[model samples]
Target chain A: MFNKIYAFIKRDVTIATSYKLSFFLRFFGMFFSILVFYFIDKLFGSTATPYLMDYGGDYFSFVLIGIAFTSFLWAGLKSFSKVIRRGQMMGTLEAMLITPTRISTIILFSSIWSFIATSVTALLYLAIGGLFFGVDLGSANILSTAIVLVLTIIAFSSFGILSASFIMIYKEGDPINWLFSSSSTLLGGVFFPIEVMPDWLQSISKILPITYSLDAMRLAILKGYAPAALTHDILPLIGFSAIVMPLAIVSFYLAVNKAKMNGSLTHY
Target chain B: MVNTVEYSIETKGLVKSYPQPRNFFEFFRGTEKKPVTALDHVDLKIKKGEFFGVLGPNGAGKTTLTKILCTLVLPSEGEVRVNGYDVVKNGGGVRTSIGLVSSDERSFYWKISGRENLVFFAVLNNHSWSRAKERAAEVLEIVGLESAADRRFETYSSGMKQKMAFAKGLLNDPQTLFLDEPTRSLDPNAAKEIRHFLSSLSKQGKTIFLTTHNLAEAEQLCKRVAVLHRGRVQGVGSKRDLGRMLTRGERLMLVVSGLEKPGISRLETLSVVDSVGVEGLGGGRVRLTLELAEGSVSTVLSEALKLGLQIHSTRTEEASLEQIFEKLTTEEV
Candidate 1:
């Protein structure tokens, strides 16, 4: 299993880096976005906002973690379907499935490179912020942060797999992805605190895994909260994972069988 | 292998259909349209070491059959087994025992080297990394792509990419290999190279199920061929045997000398002779073309001898594969 995952990752890395200009452009764009966010935070100055008081009241640090981890949300919710769509367009889906490798294994491993690349981008965001934007990570709690990130990925990946199920059959126009992505950006505390929203919208935000994920992440990283103290966010993320993962797996399984029957497994 | 079963590939009553679109009125009335049947009741059995070709025109369900046997598509009806594993119940087992060579060259990553592609596919087939590297090189050499193996796939010619596909198929050393239109769009020389490589693989005693529209390729490589038309198997037999079926009406050409008008009639009266055409030669010798019903050439000869004709030479003209394919696929068939 590890061998197969490594092989796919190597293949993607080779292909991804083959586009030399696009590769460099991505990094440049990452820095550009970071700088844009830094300036906006500068306009706010050192003025403390009540919404961010729970996490050192630094809006730049709070929003930095939020926007950086949004990439993870996109990776989890979009990578599987993007991989499938790319495979279909590139005409590699049949070739890949024709191997003895199981379909489930392919789906599970197809997004590893996306997640890994997203992690690097996320880390780069934190590094740039800490070095130049006056954002401090001296109080970071590594272990608690790692646990929340894992659970967050699992919870987010459930939605990703479900979106992939729709992509597998429909070929395009995945509804699940748009619903989660737009909602997560607007209400899941990515660019702003959920507390800043009205009471009704905050209730809606409470149901989203991203809201808990971002909250726990900010508390752990900025406030240096211990694992024992992070249970308030940890339990809900685990519950979401426990409930959604099986549903996603079963949905994907059904979608694959339908594709095989429809003879559209390779059809685009 | 093949569960000790003699046949490497087998199918019974196989059927596949694609759903059809309905009109607005039909949709409103809930009238379901009949699906387009791609394969209708195809029954086939291929021996473990035979090179079998499924001959068909475009849209003839040859690829559908290949996909079903490869466990890539599910049959709407019927049972399919490859290497003795039921395709539906044990697709993984079937997949493990078979390989595929698809004509779709876009299947490979354009940015990677041919060797890199093969090694990755080999890994997918459960080969250890070291073993995959070894097998990748071995198959690349077998396909004569060693020199070009390091070049990116997009830079390779059409022929080279097809050969890389072949190398990938051979990575697992499968018991049964499916080649779907293996030489679809190659230049004549490039196609001949692929055909020659296919001949070598056939000699290695692997069961090769080839789907092709090229009658010459099938005739040259396959021992037995199945002609599929309209999602149905029109006929399945050795190429020579299929040719014999085509020749049933006009079986042989007998050139003779010293045969007269009376003798031609007498020879025609024989029960085995379906019809006889006599063309006069200048020196009172005539060439007789005999179409036989159910008798040996010797019987025709003896009967012609009784008619006081001199036999010069007899030639049994076999129908070309093209002619047989045309006969099988035509609507009249």
Candidate 2:
């Protein structure tokens, strides 16, 4: 299993490196976006916002962490569906499906390289924030941050698999991707804290796993909260992973079975 | 030999159907469509270490059967077992025991090298990285792609891409190999090479179940062949048996220049001739096709000579596999 995963990563890395310009362009694109955010942070003049004061005193650091975490969230939430779409387009999906590996194993391993790429982007975000934007991570709790990151990835990837199931069956017009992407971006506290929303809207935000993930990450990275003190955010993320991962797996299995019964597994 | 051989693949009354759209507005009305049968009660048994062929025209369910045997598609209403394991209950087992090659050239990642693609698939078959690399090299060499192993698959010509697909199928060293039109896109030379390679693999005791529209290919590689038409197996046997099923006698074509009416009547009186067809060719020449019962070619020829019919050419022909396939598929059962 490890060897299969390693092979998938190696293949993706080789392909990624082949397009030298695009590979370097992505980093440059992310770097310039951070610089844009840095100027916006200056416009806010270091005034402590009510929503961010508890997590961090500066908008720059708060939004930087949010951007970094959301990058991971995007990778986790889109990787599986993206791979499925590519497989279908390239006509490799049936070839992969006919292998001895389980469907879940294929989905999981195919997304590993995307997650690794996002992790590097996340690190670059932190580096740019610290070196030029005056963001501080000296007080960060590395162990607790790692735990939050893992749990968050698990929860987000569950939804990714669900989106991939839709792709496998529908071939186009996946409602899950649109619904999840819009809702999470609007309500998951990626830009400002959810407290700024109306009371009823905040209730909607509370139900999203990304909300808890971003909150936990902020508490660990900015507030330096210990694992015990981070229970409020960690518990929901873990609970989401535990419940949704199985559901995603079952949904994907059923989708595959439906395709098989319809004799459309290899059809685009 | 087939009767006593162990079976590697068996399907009992297998059926598969796909839902068909009712009308253009059916999607908006949320109405269900009727189902169209792709395979109706297909029962097949392939012996271990035997090279088997399924010959059919387009939309004849050859590909559907191959997909079901490879565990990529489900049989709607029957049991399918590959290598003693049920396809549904033990798909992983079946998958591990079988390798598949289809005509689709886009199955490999276009951006990756041919070696990378093979190694990745080998690893997916549960080989360690080192072993996968070794096996990938071995199969690449076997398929004659070792020199171009490091080139991106997208850069390969269509024939080279097909060879790479063959290499990928051999990566697992599977017990049984399923090939669906494996030489469909190849030029004659490449196609012949693949045929030779597959024949060698059969000699090594690997069970090969091939589906193809090329009758000559089937005739060359398969010891036994099944003809499928309209989602049903028309006939299943060796070339001789299938030919015998279609005709109990022989067909002979005689090109001759006729002299008189009595000669035709005299030739028709021979005891061996079942039926005769005469078509006028211009310039006082005629083509006579004689359908005779078995062991009647010599008698018919002698009778024609005794009739004093000036023979331009005499050719003895038997029922070919192509003729048998055409007769069986075109005629209603």
Candidate 3:
């Protein structure tokens, strides 16, 4: 299974490399998104500057960390969309489905390549922001931030696979990508604090778990919160992962079985 | 069920169906729809080390049966077993025991070389990387693709792609092989090469189940052939056995120059002769069509000689597999 994963990852990475312009455009596209957020922060003036002052971190640094973490989280979710949509366009999804390996393993392996690609792009954005944009590394909770980043990615990817199962069964025209993009940008606390949401929306935000992910990541980067400081939200993230991961796997299996029953598993 | 000691594949009343939408709304409602039966109670047993060919026109359930036996698709009703393992209950084991090669060679990653594709599929079947590479080399050599194995499949000729598909089918050295139109798109030379290679492979211990519309290919390669038409098996047996099933068995068509008359009564009255007719021929030569008992060609010849008529040329013709297939399929629907 590890070998299968390795083979798939290597092949996909090579495939990504073959399309160099697309890779560079993806990197630049996410880079400009951060630039837009940076300008918005600048437009907010002292209102945003004071909040970072209270947190004892630079405002630019805070937004950079937020964007980086959110990028990886969204990257994890987008991995499934990439596999489903691009794979369908390339006529490879059915071929990949016919393999005897479990779908979860293949999805995981296929998505790992995208995760690595997105992470590298995120790292490049960070480096460029830190070097040329005067973005500081703010606090020294690097280890905690890394741990939270990994956990949040796993949680988001579980949901992504769940969404991908729906795509496998019924193609909704990339609605999951649209849903993830808009919701995470607006409600996931990517550019703003979740506390600013109204009570009802805040309650919904609390249930989302990505809000907590961004909060924990924000605290770790700005306030130098210990890894245990995020422990309060860990249970909820674990709960979401626990419930959604198995549901995603089961849904994937059911979808594949349906395809097989219909003899569409081999259909291009 | 096939006896474990003698058979490699068996299907008992196997049936498969796909639900057809009743109307447009049912597509979204996911309600039950009328099902289209692909295979209807197909019962077959293939012995170990036997090369069995399935001959059918398009949409005749050959692919559906192959998919069921390969464990890619489950039967809606009945049971199928491969290598003594129930296809439904022991699907993984059945998958491991058999190798399937479909017409869709494009399923493999086209950018990768043929050798890499083989190694990838090999690793999926649990072979080590070194073993995969070694076995890929062996299969490439076997399929006569060693010279071009390192080239991308996207750059290959259709025949080369087919040869590579065959190589992948043999990568795991599977005990049972299922090939669906393995030479469908090949040129004559490549098709003949694959046929000979498959024949030699079956000469080894592997059992092969193949589907093809090419009757001559089946006749040349298969020890036993099953004729499928309209989603049903019309007949299943060896070439001679299927030939005997037709009403006009052991037919001997001749164009004799020595016939004095177009409808010769002496030729009609020959012993073992079922019917004799002189079909039209130019320049006074008569084309004779003779029907005889399945094994009585020699008696018809001697009876013609006893008439004291000089025999210019005589040729005994048995029903070709092509003719038998046409007769079986073109029967009353």
DockQ for each numbered candidate: 0.77, 0.79, 0.43
Superior candidate under TM-score, 1 versus 3: 1
Q: Which CAPRI tier for candidate 2?
A: medium
Residues A2-33 of candidate 2: C-alpha lDDT, one tens digit per residue: 89889989989998998999988988998888
Candidate 1: where are CA atoms >4 Å away?
A: A45-48, B1-4, B21-31, B247-250, B254-270, B274-290, B298-313
Q: Give the number of the best model, judged by DockQ.
A: 2
lDDT of 1 by residue, A25-109 (tens): 9889988988887788879736637768899988889889998888999999999998889888998888888888998888678
lDDT, residue B233, candidate 2: 89
Top lDDT hit: 1
- The model with the greater DockQ, 1 or 2, is 2
Model 1 / residue A262 / CA error / Å: 0.9
Q: Which of candidates 1 and 2 reaches a greater TM-score?
A: 1
Q: Write the per-residue lDDT of candidate 2 for residues B1-333, one digit (tens) a residue.
A: 223237898888899898884665888898986789999898888999999999988898998899988888888888888888789889999999999988998789999999999999999888999999999999988988899999999899988998888888888888899998999978999899889999999999999999998999999999999999989989998987786666557778999886477877776777777678888999999999887777878888888887788889888777788998899889854
TM-score-wise, the better of 2 and 3 is: 2
> Which structure is stronger by lDDT: 1 or 2?
1
Q: Candidate 1, what DockQ?
A: 0.77
What is candidate 3's CA lDDT for residue A51? 51
Question: By summed lDDT, which 10 consecutive residues of candidate 2 chain A come out lowest?
Answer: A44-53
- After superposition, the stretches of candidate 3 with alpha carbons farther than 4 Å from their true spots are A50-59, A81-100, A171-181, B27-32, B254-278, B282-286, B296-314
| TM-score, one value per model | 0.93, 0.92, 0.88
